[model samples]
Target: MFQNLSERLEGALKVIKGKHKITEINVAEAVKDVRKALVEADVNYKIAKEITERIKEKALGQKILIAVEPYQLMIKIVEDELAQLMGGQKADLMLTGSPAVVLMAGLQGSGKTTFSAKLANQIKRQGRQVLLVACDVYRPAAIEQLKTLALQIGVDVYSEPENNNPVAIAQNAIQYAKANHKNVVIVDTAGRLAVDEEMMNEIEKIKKAINPCEILFVVDSMTGQDAVNTAKAFNERLDFTGVVLTKLDGDTRGGAALSIRAVVEKPIKFIGTSEKIDGIDVFHPDRMARRILNMGDVVGLVEKAQQAFDEKEAERLNKKLRQNQFDFNDFLSQIQQIKKMGNIKDLMSMVPGMSKMMKDVDIPEDAFKSTEAIIFSMTPKERENPQLLISGNGSGSRRKRIALGSGTSIQEVNALVKQFEEMRKVIKKINAMQNTGKKLGKIFGR
Candidate 1:
């Protein structure tokens, strides 16, 4: 997402590379480049200058370690400052009261409605009964849109289609939650094209009426500095508890994420990483800073994996692998689990050093479509027994049928069968080695 900024920052750090000491001349040169990078990434000029000045001071005043290179020290300093510029740590939502109320606010087209559903889905996954309150009475079909999303996420939505008062809708929704035993009520309020008194007043009244435990101001990160300014206005009026940056997966310069907390004095609670309902992630400043500097977020990647992979299913797959029973059905299930982890490119970028390596690589979202299609075309027997599709007397006809069903060439089917056979062999070898290891451990007792 911050590819250009990351590349520029890397180039900037190279200014002091190979230098034994952090000299003022080299530090100034590096700091200048860093400032330029930040500015080019749509960060405010004054904020960029201030942060770069701190970096410069830290570089000059620090005592260099024997093992740490000058470039490495500078990277650490920049990463720390960037994290500080954003929130120093992750901010969590306060879900208090019998039914905690969360008020959503933002300008029109800021993804306020969509993020409401995403948040509800996340809270529902956390074992809470969530009620999505659609208070956008002015916009046509806004309530219906929320209803559709709520249905997709399997959450209840409260809306008064005929009622124009958002404050009343919110108040009634809270009552509904109490009566229905819902523990969380997320009120999605309306937004205008620009910040205005009417929109501000309505949201403020709703906030007062509902007394939300958290007021999240959602903004489009692609809006750059404008998102920061809009957040400032909302914070001044409604005094939001936190910020939510949406559309972060777009071709954004990342200025809003870096500047909003410094400007509005609020923590960024969550970021919308993709369009999927499960695309939301708790904003972690240190991880994001590392990512911006091209040092990938291993912790975040692991968290994604933990969320996507089901424990019971994982145990099942492990048993299959250990028994050398890994088949196409199991392989397809694994692919689906990985797809649930969000965008392929985004997931890969989380690996250490992969972001820089994939800077120019275009990994499409549907990169696995062909593989999935080919697998789906196989019969249950064929999927369970890989040998059924291999090159043989009867296997040729089976492969041809699969190729026709999957809309792929015969050569593609043959290649997939060959790859699957190789994979099965590898699994068998691994299982054999594991068995041998266990036997040796039992035999060589002290």
Candidate 2:
């Protein structure tokens, strides 16, 4: 996820670490390194050169500031340029009309189908009645895959499996949506291995028949420069309103994301961050630049937390913490919510300075599996009253039983109980500090 590019850029910007001013000599050296880094990251050589030139020009034109370091200023300059290259601002989907139609277009294996379901899920979460239309008549079981995804996301689907006519399927889907009162229609069209006259003509015909509000071209970011070329062809034909980059979580060089918008003259509206249905994110260039520069995306992290954590459940947990009643039940519920927040390591990397610190650390995806299993093995009473297993009366026997039931060692069970108790104690300490703060406010009488 741009990790290599970030590390290389950081190294390039380090040229001005000890300098007090942004001199032309230092700027040239930095820009050269930056250009090399971008080229190595699969960026178009011309675009990379052009961007580095702009960065150099900006760096030389800026005055030395007393409040900011030269290296920090260089980073800011590069971040701004990168963001501008990737569509200076976020572009939102135009979901207007009684049943706003969005046509999906891209080459095969570009994740067009998956992104369609993801888009529908996103709109459905926004309080809209979304109908996912399956028009990929050539791909075997493409309609079934879409139906499965729609079912998982609790969205409706309109498909004519027997009818191989995608153009008619899309038109009928819109008519079906209008009759069913669905406010949004996402037509997933068939894609070819390579752009051809037949494939292009079919999608164009579907576009003409549907009269969609938004036409999104989904591309596989892992495809590198090929993705950009494919996007250019699609844009030339369909003139898509926006772009969607999928497989961004893979080991991609990120050239597609950096070059597609500039090449096609379209904004990147969405990015698939993970394989989960909820992994789709509205593209934000500024936040992306921050992440690439090791600045971290705090706002994005907060948004993910807000979406994953239930407000009512959090309020209840706060009350319990204040009362020192934070039990295993609440702990289990918290774990479930955190698991829904997507990849653990990716979530941690969103915090400031954590990405660099955890670069070499291997955080397993199943890190919480053992803990969850142990807790699930516990009886309802044991979960409600963790004290029952921690008390000195029969602690050892109870732990052994838990270890056996959970298929874990006794030492692991003991360690989990100890960690849980420590967490409860920390909550108690926080509650005490809050109480002390209130008492001091009363005493000060200010």
Candidate 3:
């Protein structure tokens, strides 16, 4: 997720970071490095040059305060320009009609089908009845793929397996949505390996027939410069309402995200962060710019947390923590909640200063597999009362059994038990301190 670009930008900014003041020579040096970094990241040479020139001008024009350093101000200027380049603010989907039709468009293998389902899932979560329409009658198993994804997200999908007319299918799907009381209908159209006249004409017909409120051009962000070019072609014909960049979780150099808006003149409405149905996110240009600069996105992190965690469950956990009753069951529930927040590494990178530290660190998607296995192997009693495995005559035997059941070593079980015990002790100490503070407050009341 722009990891290389982040590092390069950091290095570029270091040129003026240590300087006592800003100067034309230093600004030029840093701007040159910044341009090179953007180019290496697959950004168009012209866009890179233009952005760098703006950065240079802003950097030289700033009246540095006594407290503000050259580098700090320089970072701020770059962040602003980057945000402006990516479409100053987030562009939301316009669901205007009674049964708003959101059409998905893109080349084959660009993730339109997957994004359609993801978008459906997102809208469904918002309490809207979303119907996913499978209009991709060209590609093999395209209809089946959409159905499977729709099933996974528990959303209704409208498809006519026997009908080859995508435009008719889309039209019928909208009618079905209207009759079924659906609020939104997302029509996933067929795409070709390359942009062909037939493909374009078919999508155009679908658009004209449906008169969709929003036509999203889904492009594979991993395609780099080709993504920008493809977007331009599609925008020329369809005049898409917005862009959806997929595969941001892949080895993307981030050229598409940076260049697409400028070239296609369309705001990026959403980003496919991962392959999971819940991995799609609304694009926020300022947050992404901060992330590219390694400044982290605390707001985005909090938003993810809010979406993943339930208020009732959080209150229950808080009560358990206050009473020092946190156990393996509670811990396992916490792990599940964290997993719901998306990729572990991506979540960590959202914390300030963690991105650079985790750049080279390989945190696998299944990092919690062993821990989950160990927890699952434990008996209900042991899960409820973790102290049962800490200080009893049969504790060692219980641990041995758990290790065998979890396919782990006895030493691993011992390490987990020790860590859990330490965590409980810390919780107890915090609870005790809180109680003492309450007592002091009651006694000192005037």
Models 1 onward score TM values of 0.97, 0.98, 0.98
Best by lDDT: 3
Lowest lDDT block of 10, candidate 3: 191-200
TM-score of 3: 0.98
lDDT of 1 by residue, 1-446 (tens): 89889999999999999999889999999999999999999998999999999999999999998999999999999999999999999999999998999989898889999999999999999999999999999888899999999999999999888888989999999999999999999999888644577777777788889899999999999999999988887788888899999999999999889989999999999999998888899999999999999889999999999999999999999999988888999999999999999999998889879998887899999988888999999999889888777745699989889889999999988888888889989989988898999999999974
What are the lDDT scores of the predictions, listed in order? Answer: 0.91, 0.90, 0.93
What TM-score number comes out for model 2? 0.98
User: Ranking under TM-score, best-scoring first?
Assistant: 3, 2, 1
Cα distance off (Å), candidate 3, residue 24? 0.6
Give the runs in model 3 whose Cα sits over 4 Å from its true position: 193-195
Residue-level error in angstroms, candidate 2, position 104: 0.4
* Model 3 Cα shift for residue 31 (angstroms): 0.3
The TM-score measured for candidate 1 stands at 0.97
lDDT of 3: 0.93
| TM-score-superior candidate, 1 or 3 | 3
